[model samples]
Target: MALVGPEEPHYCNHHVVASTGRTRKMTLVRALRPFRVVRRTLAVFTLGAMVIVSFALLPSNVADAATVPVSTQAVVQTAPDLAKICARLKITVARTSLCSHGPDPVDAFGGGARLKQTSAVQEQGVAAAPASELTALCNADGVSGKRIEVIYGVPQDRTNRFSAMVAPLRDMMRQVNNNLEAADAATSQNYRFLCTNGVDVTVRNVTLLPVGSDASFTFDDYVASLQNQIAFGLGPVDFIANERLYIAYIDQVQDSYPFGGQGELSIDDQPSAAANANNDSRPRYSMSAYLDMPVMAHEIGHNIGAVQDSAPHSSKGGHCYDEADLMCYDDGGLYFALGGTLTFTCPGADTAIDCHDEDYYYPGTPPASNYLATHWNTANSGFLTPVVSAATPPTVTGKSPVSQATRVAQTANATATFSEAVQGVSTTTMRIKNPGGTVLSSAVSYNTTTRVATINPSASLAADTKYSVSLTGGVTGIRDLSGSPLVSTGWSFTTGPAPTITTRTPGSGATGASRTASVSVTFSEGMAGVAASTFKLKNTATGAAITALVSRNGTTNQWILNPSATLAATTNFTVTITGGSTAVRDLAGNPVSTSIWRFTTGS
Candidate 1:
């Protein structure tokens, strides 16, 4: 039996024994005094002038046959508290008490402390290992299955420093591939890893900028710089669905604290320029120049959507409790032994303590069950599939008020129909700007069924004013389901002059009007349609309602209201236009406001 530290290599010592008929290899340790030993026969012989003693004995059944020379000391080699281990490494954990009783801690040595405090590495801008010569680090000969491209970038000024990291980065990636392959084999999946080679791999020299007052730059800022490079044809072609882009820089990343890398499960295909040139359906991840195999594998695990702290895996809260799990915080091994094996042995299965039990462990306030059984099952076999093609870019096919059109309604909602169904087409992407380029306060929404994006201003537009609607494009622009972005452009239109009642047949305050006379109102602009329900005729004295039929003349923009019955004699009749419906809109769909007029009917 052998005992090793959490992160140390395994070691075993063996001794060969010659028996009467067969040769058996046996392991002997000095610490085996507790168990009773029954000896039946003994023999002594001399080989090369050295005396050798042998004995055949009946061993006690107290120990397992597989673990030879087992003793009390070997079985009692307990692991230390995780909190103590973290404290010794100068790393901080959210819950110290929980960690105290959690999993055993992995020993820290040879820059292991830096790996434990990922955020510290970013803050201090510390390098993990010395740089080496630049060379072809990854082996491509054995990769015959599915491949994912990796693009590494560095600041132009720090090329030499980043070049030295190629060897270690290659080693880390190889380990990650090996671990993933082992996991797939255990889970009965067929996912394999391929290193981007030849023209597929990219090495970019980018400009570094400080984030706010901080001395370091952010991953998002770096991504933006990469985008700018792509836009200018200096960066790699648009990432395809199967590729991932990793930017390596000397400065610390803003959000990556206590970790060496950060990544997303997947990313939308944004426009890019590279050898492949096609839009990629996969997401990209980033790493600091200072990284190790375990940390690198951990980030790739995120890309694999493992142990997510949401939905089906909410109970795991970002990681499994098993210390041997590659997804755990104390991860140190190169293989998956927890959820990947599908044979779950709850940590501390025999103990009644809540902290020892996997089910009652509350890494979160509301205790959650270990969701490993839910996500790591055989049913979710396709979790490792890569997204394939980029989505088609959305195009504007039509607008409510056609470009450069006159007589646009002030109350009309600004609408633009796209060539395909799109999402996230809200106020953030679509904007209505006045001639002065000031964005108007408006609510923007997209209708999937109609493929239309509508922007309704908080208030009606200024009459006779010019406004332009702009939609953004590129990575941050509005995108379709496949993440293809829309091309950005602006269209302008002038609002029509304020609509007014130019003439009324039954003039306001008219006296001695015929009881059977119909009323007519003419507007300056063409009306969309008038609803009969919008016209209300009532006798003021009796407060009696009168129903009427309303009709509109398309060319004249006039609304005619004829009472269903004769108006009351010697009575003051009021005709009112009740608005607030699609029925009473202008040609541009602007609803009219309430209008009232009165006339006296003859007796």
Candidate 2:
């Protein structure tokens, strides 16, 4: 589908009979003529057989004859125009296309007969042509029992942020399924609807070559490279015979416009021979991270064989004729019609389809000859089946330095572990704050393998201090693989006790210490706030105080006191730490013990 385009208002195909209506009407009448003739012939034959059988056969034989299965070939031969439409539209019978010519002279009798036979034999009657094939002839068609696999390609640099795309993609899938269901219910046809058989998301790390200004590498080249990368990363695809493999490349770079996603109706050169050999070569589709629900739904619609130019119902616009159709230029509003009214709305209003009464398809009118009808039958052959269950969300299972635990090491890194691997764990989502509400400067890293996120503070935390670590939760917060956000919660931890002075320079009661020597103190742990007022030197007998400069060595956590002048000669000097007014304190705010110790200077 074109990602960007001018708004071209095209009337619903259901309302405006095509310009080729006369020719098609003639063709339809011609097609119905043979069916009328066959019905008349069967009516005459039934009357004759009933009279003859009653006279010659027992009641049991009559019942047995009535239960005999009829040839599916007879139905197709009688309705030549319907067979022509099925073959021309490339509609499949069972899993085989009606167009393919094998030994099967009856175009509709090949695989479709088997499907009908299964039901007809059980009902003790002639097998009727599969309802899905008949439905496709009358209105929209579908192929049931088809499987699709969704694989996501993630570049190495964007692995951590991969969670950002998860929710959007999952939502897109849900919308796709819902749209299919709505289409199935609105159509008059019956077929097994397409269902999400299985979805697998794999994150493959790839090194993308730099794109040069001259356009050294094209987007196709990148896609080819990514295809090769997937081959090398995941090896071969081991899907079943009916399963399809679709690769969606979620890159950090945006793709060129009008190509949000694209895929082939049938992929022949799959990585594995088994996949290539499966069910007439299952189709493949791809999209970038920059994709919306409508775009994705449109691309996948192409893969399912809709709006093809080759079909009689198709028009000049190919898959893009109806403005309000999903295959059209618009978002094909999620619609379900009831009675005569159309109920329609776009998902999150992020699509181009105008959700107005005029933009929708009503019942009883000619069904919209668009992808909506062509691919959305819910009978046995409908493109989508019912989903079994909803997806599971990821959660946080454990955290380091357990919440409210005390005596945690000052240098320990804070970590959080999730129940499953998660991405988008950055400093913005996870943080540590001191008791004062200041966020600590730290580097955050997430280990995808371990599913753990670690926050390493730039410096050791304050001793005996309480700190809170939090993981933000919201639509934009950290998310798990399924794109569910973590529950916002804070966990606090307290560091061990504050450090104290273990030793001091100039032992107390020393008789003859050098007068020029400086005084110093050593602490049991890191300390701060060294100042002269915290330590004082004075002449013991004269009561003369000496000024000193004070500073702490960060490496050693030692405070040095340098006297302003040489101590008085032949004086007994005393050093004191004023308890109440002392400015010195450890990193955890515990002040040093107040004490006085003296040593006599040399005479």
Candidate 3:
């Protein structure tokens, strides 16, 4: 199926939606990122703010946080900021007297309007009493003042102190923003900012307050009391204007303490009411910037064009460690990217590089940057322009004359120099297609900052054959860190004859039913032909290999035999050839990479 665009969810593909094992709409909703709720809610936060807030302060050691199998306990422990968390969430709020709506929040799509409310004070599915009320409920339950102090941070004895405490955090946010912007420029990939017609950002000022400390809910209450005020109190008009993003702030109803030795981003979720109630009087608390910030961006990133990783339920979506997926459930508070963080390479040692991981930032130990940059300054640096001309495919005018081949037991090394560091075509996307149109294997891999995909086929190449390596669709998905797709068309090349195979040294042998053995096959030609390590010897039973090995006689085509261990006696064996059949020709310009034959070992 064609790739789904950002605004157009993957669910649009009937194949994807139906195959996910759910009703269509629900699958579509599932296809959206976790932040989809936030994106659909806020719709107008700043892109820069989103990136910084999401990635900065991620602690490095969150993997060690307390674990609770139960969802309630998990939520509480994972979100330690719950006590300090006030629902400043911008929701549609209205008083009962002037409004027909009830106090409960609405799930409009779920036919929430049909749900009945018994009283004016009653909460609709979507609406709720003011946050102040929530705070009162939290405090009356015996939550402590110290926890409250942690949530609001001493309420600033004076404006100066308030600014003093918030300034450093603000500076940290700014640094994160700058880093993202630079990386975006370097990679030419869009970051938090989305550019469909115009740029759309997601974020806003967040505030936190201790619950039940005051008789009134402070400014948040006033905002919540507005005629059409929504829950969490963000105005509805703001959302209407930036329909693609979300802007939200933080507020808590009760007192909570920030966890020590953890970055604000590194903090875990607050414990639930039941868990907190069972604790001591000094009630501990935690406000997670890690979960919060990424959640913010995750919501916003959903607004941008990227497919939701709705693979959790499908076997086809096997890799749970898809850090590149914004919709990946595992990405919750851990991830470095704002809009475009999916990477081909693994994340570095720095945990805070993403949102949910350890967010604690200290000097000298900086978070790892995504290899691909997300933005490009068109006016300053012209990296946005195409690097290669579209006139024709690049021709291989010269090649590295040095060539070496080895048996499965030995390592073969070869390096070819390109005319230039060609753009568009990445090493990872390069595939070696056989004459039968079957792809032997991909010849690309993501290495360091560059795409350096290589392949040592599972089977050996035949002797003296001419093979062709055609490059088709080799540069489509490859983008620089700045998110620019490869500009040039794909290219390929044909190589010289394959090395000659002499004879197997231990020709036609069997073992005493040993499980593992490295079987080696030698070649008669020089060890300068195609890669020979790709050969394999398989057992007839389950088509499994007995750890057979292959090696060349350093100078001649004489190959050696060695298996990881001895093989089973009287076992049926078949040789499977693979690497590049077309790329590896036999002595008479014939491809033999696919030639397979069977033999029996002595019992």
Candidate 4:
């Protein structure tokens, strides 16, 4: 079903698109660089009020925070101030988007209602296994055999504040996963990070870096240090052959840093893949900036695969220019960097991965030989929920009195089931109106657990009237929690009298009825579903129904009941058309009130 979402994100379809440009990028092999746009958001929330709030809220991802016996460490000093973080990064630029917005609370969607920004959405699903309860394999939860290991990487010179961060880190990661889950929900997929027993992110039992963070570290330094440390520490078993993405959450003062985190981009623009240390075509490691959910999601987004140079909207440093998208920003190449205007109209959720599917992420079975198909697809990433064809925004999956249904009960509640859980439903979003278009007073409520939204009229509907039910979607309209707006859809149904048998063959209680002939009953209106349960023949004395072959004559609006055998002479039989919702219904779905008639057969 078509879902109403933000104006389809604008993209020049024919611009730079190639069936295969593998030749150009084949020789330009490079790992992730430091200044990608996603890393530009300088949200230093962990050092401010968010740490105070998020730390206190029990992470829904973790079943329990106290269960994992963690290593003890020094009490963490108050998180670094925004000034300290920006200073550490040597950011002389004035604060606006990322750098200074750390302490100033803002909506996660950034500038629009189209998509949900990357933040923790409370998921009412089963709790992921705690760290201590993790299974023998890394595939215990999401994406088989691969995992994103979370670590509280401490700086040796800064301080070992491991103990204080366990809960906060788990909570922080929970926000990231929730956003991912929301994205998955939007795409009609189920992608999520591996949540092992420890911190809902693997850190405890798995080998983590023992060396602490050093002062004045660079992106290159961090990458090389961790790679070397893990290579030496893992000792050939999990290290040399390991194909996991390691996420390090360090409590370092982030001043003077140009990036919040850096990760190796495993997506190759070339069609023929080259062999690597992990063998799998996915990023192996990402570091820092995870204390913030959006940045964490952005960094990890690079790890899985996204915003590649091959994308239509891609910029020089691996970002999109479609404003309001989590990955879109003016990072120096695309429209935003070329001095073009941005509408801030990114579709779906603020944290939505690819503003337009054609660019970095394709929710569909990518057409053969295209950039999306040849390059790694985030929708098909081993770490995400398996893809199912193309993904559409959440929509009304089912509805009551489906379009064009007749004979709807005036008191019946008009219910709608969404493909996934949605929010912002009201009379303004959904409504029932008469044929003349006067809206009925209605109440709408949504059930998060069932993903159903219900709407009921304040009073019973009018009899014999045609009414329509409409649901609206778009930015500021009905939207799924994951960020897709329901596309507007409505069906009309007529309300009227239930069909009744207008006349019966051989008038009721007639002295003689033809034993060799069939019995017929005509209804007041055209009939649709007529079954044995609704149309039955029974011996008046024995009360046993006669087996009969029933057929309808559309021209006459009549149902003919022919018994399997000749009727007994001089016997009285009763014919009944049972009513009620499940009984015999008319084309308009109105059921006939129960009616019974008796006739005597000829001797």
Candidate 5:
């Protein structure tokens, strides 16, 4: 595949503690062996802080993702752990441990994205008010668009404390969202985090994480228990499956040393039924509680798809290769494969995404050849904001063949070129019909790159016929990307004249022609097909047709009549091009009229 991108990564919003001014050197060694199971929920990369970069490549066709909805099921079907699952599918998997950081820490509390809550503060059923400074961090009232739904979960023995921390979580996410906006200023787009839309949305007392009496629980255990109890976010329904990124705030940590959080990497949401399975679709609910806002950001990054293996700096383990960005790490994510080293290139703020813009997030339109343009981009995730505006955008015409034009080609298809990208291209929307209003059997197709929609007729148009093209629909019809319709009476044109003999080899009534000579003829227009019965060579004296093989040259538009036996020497022979709609015809179905010519052959 030809990858189109800048040789070096785009350094747009470089937020780093130190600009070492280092150039990231890379040696790309394709898989030494076959690629095996690489987890979407990869190892947490932490410099005493939690982090996870989700990685998955999305489908290419969908205009916008319709996320899977959460279903009201009592129990969720759980799959085997990553290794076992891969084994069943006959894939070899080897575990690689990767976690480190870029620049030295400046703050004692330090910085990390996605993590565990250090303290379990208690409160009543109501939520705790945020610190005055954190109030503006979130907007929960009118802008109540889609967000990450937070749940309060604890071991059966422990009390749930997330109910008290709703505002704080929202505020933390608000801070992350705001930081994303700042990073994306170059793209001219605002960013928002997945948060509780309106009120403090929390599902309390779902399932229990392993604690107290429970023995050695794996990371998967925590997610499974909670998933079994919470009755939503299964999928299929658009909003339910996709609208919310369901995450739970568990009050306790597990025996597992790396207990920040993890999520399934849907990569890019491939909308097909099989591709959109279990957690494979929606980053379907795995990551858990962490007071650090960036931790949530990093963990959620996995759920929505980021850091594809094909990315320039990708670690191949679902994390980025460089340092200082939220997903990048000091201990190369692809340690065993890439020699386990990363240069401290683009040092970034606590909320950094890719060290450079080439890995995951791109605010503006990406180059058609850029990695972000093809892979799943976190910025396109449905959980972000401001919600896409519902307003309809108009579709304007760029150009088309003028109406009432004459001598149009019989086999030419009709097209409408638009100045802007359009959406509707179904047969019902873009149309081709006879002047009498009879719709023709045709298919409609649109090319986004060229901004053109075409009407391809099933068969060629008839010769000397008038056909009309029209686009219909109000705001909802043959519309632009923004839902504005292409409402036009369209245009029409008339096909050119009928087919006639343009060339005849061996002149009419010519005498002394060689008996072995083959007869040839050409037509004025390109023919749809040549009929065997239409070409003939016969001895005029005997009144019998000559056995001959007829062959046509489409490129030269010539038909050759070769007799099986040599023509009778010194005999008068006749040649004919039989015609009518059923015989030799042009693409427009216009026939070549029956034509005859006679010649006497020489011995």
Candidate 6:
């Protein structure tokens, strides 16, 4: 698995006392070890006592996530300690912990993106939030966003003072929220709920906690608690069962000792700093806190949406000024300079501006995209700002051609609002079988006002023919709210066929003896369920028929074919799937594909 680290030239708005200007020469080490109990959640790295890591990897088709609603009974069963904590905060965990464990609930309002780790133990259960849900929430809010919930595990000696940390925590939450909202709105997908209308997302809060009276709590304990109470009420095992979720943990490993209570350290510690002349071993508590926040943010950023490769500042993954990357381990003014500059909109403004001079950092000055606006706020102002940016922005854009004949229909749409205006729609078009592979009609229509184009035959389009459409030229210009002469790239779309047989895995005239070889097929449309006994297979020679079986996989229209008995050697077999007669129907409400095929069986 490719490891993700921050880009270089670390930037933040936090303060620190010194710059060691040291680099730890690291030897290539094995990547995180896979977790056993939670097969998917691996131990990524050890930072102090905290284990900083993310889920191993998610399945390819990771888009489908579970959506079970919260159950009141489940919430009622939560441990009293958690309930008391919730009560003290005046918040209601409408859903049980199990529900809270998944990305959907934890990040419902973009809360997960703004969190940070306050204590090592808290990092134990740090799991990756679902990227789709996070992205969905970010899009809903019309901004790019992030969350980092810190669990502070203090000894009994420091327990009572938990209230003292509240103000700073609240501030951090606010800053993180603000940045998230801003990023969401300022970027694409402008609002939180494109599913809903445009609206600012209400900022979510960050929760800090003191451990319950458990004798000894291991990382798995937190995982279990979160799982039983939050994930699926089935605990961490569900992580693999439901691969959509990933986990991560970050902690401080070294002491403020021999180094003279100093917080500054290199990403790699080649050697403990040479004894300082003054031997001024004064502890810097806050600096330690500040440094860890950005590191945590950069790591979690790796697991977001689709995991992508990191482009470090020095290219070798060391500190550099251009990227404003927190992963490079650069400790300088840049970490806490974002808030100092009051100019919120100065062009070319960066998280690194004045924090760390370009000369002090290296390689081409990296871009500022990697900067965490909220973390920058935390370092500068001792708090977080809500509003990562707007979540959802809207526009009308759609598929071109409206039809295709040469290949499977492929069309795309462009959101006019996202663009400055709409150009002429494409006239060249052709229609084909809904599943494509067959050409039928080409006539298409474009709505310049709505920015949507329809492709159909000059007459009524076929009910089941999927049409591919595009927009090339010919329509009058439609300007956007920005008045920037609407310009956009091309788009595509597919027409629909009511229901038709698309393709079958084992075509007619096949001969295979493997009993495990099952027959399967794709349809032009979705199908509904019917009485299980409706489908069947038959032997052509004896005229004896058997009622084969069909079952749905996940919610897809695809079905499985179960043969009742082994095929006779050297025998002719025929399979038939009845659709309209059964309960099956395409998504368009068209009849199911009454498909049939015949093949010879070998011994």
Best by lDDT: 4
Task: Assess every candidate by TM-score.
Answer: 0.29, 0.29, 0.23, 0.41, 0.40, 0.24
Across 453-478, the per-residue lDDT of candidate 3 in tens digits comes to 34444454332321223222222443
Tell me the tens digit of each residue's lDDT in model 1 across 494-581.
6875356678778999989998878888877765435565566788777788888878665677888888898878788888765321
How does residue 66 of candidate 3 score in lDDT? 26
Q: Give stretches of model 6 more than 4 Å off.
A: 1-26, 29-394, 397-478, 481-603
Q: Each candidate's lDDT (Cα)?
A: 0.41, 0.41, 0.26, 0.50, 0.48, 0.28
Ranking by TM-score: 4, 5, 1, 2, 6, 3
- The sequence of per-residue lDDT tens digits that candidate 2 reaches over residues 239-286 is 123434353544444322112444333211121222222223433334
Instruction: Give the range where candidate 1 is weakest over 10 consecutive residues by summed lDDT.
Output: 10-19
- Residue-level lDDT tens digits of model 6 in 1-603: 112114222211111111111112222122311122232122222121121111111111113222112220011111123223323212121122110111111111111221222232223332222122223233323422222223322222122333443333322222222222222212221112211222222222211111223222223323322222222221122221221212222112122111101111112111111221011121101111221233323322222210011111121111222322222221222211221111111121121222332211111222454322111112211011222211221223322331111112223221222222334333342122222223334554445565454544444444433332222211233223333222112222223344666776567667663444555666655654333433456787787875556665566655677676666767777776665411344433234646667777667
TM-score of 1: 0.29
Q: Between 1 and 6, whose TM-score is larger? A: 1
TM-score of predicted structure 6: 0.24
Global local distance difference test of model 6? 0.28
Q: Candidate 3: count the clashes.
A: 136
Listing every candidate in turn, what is its Cα RMSD in Å to the true structure after a full C-alpha superposition? 31.9, 32.9, 25.6, 28.2, 27.7, 24.0
The local lDDT score (0 to 100) that residue 375 gets in candidate 6 is 12
- Regions of model 2 farther than 4 Å from truth: 1-145, 155-160, 184-219, 222-227, 230-242, 247-249, 255-258, 266-283, 310-317, 330-383, 386-603
Model 1 bad stretches (over 4 Å) = 1-112, 116-146, 156-162, 181-213, 232-258, 266-280, 309-317, 330-603
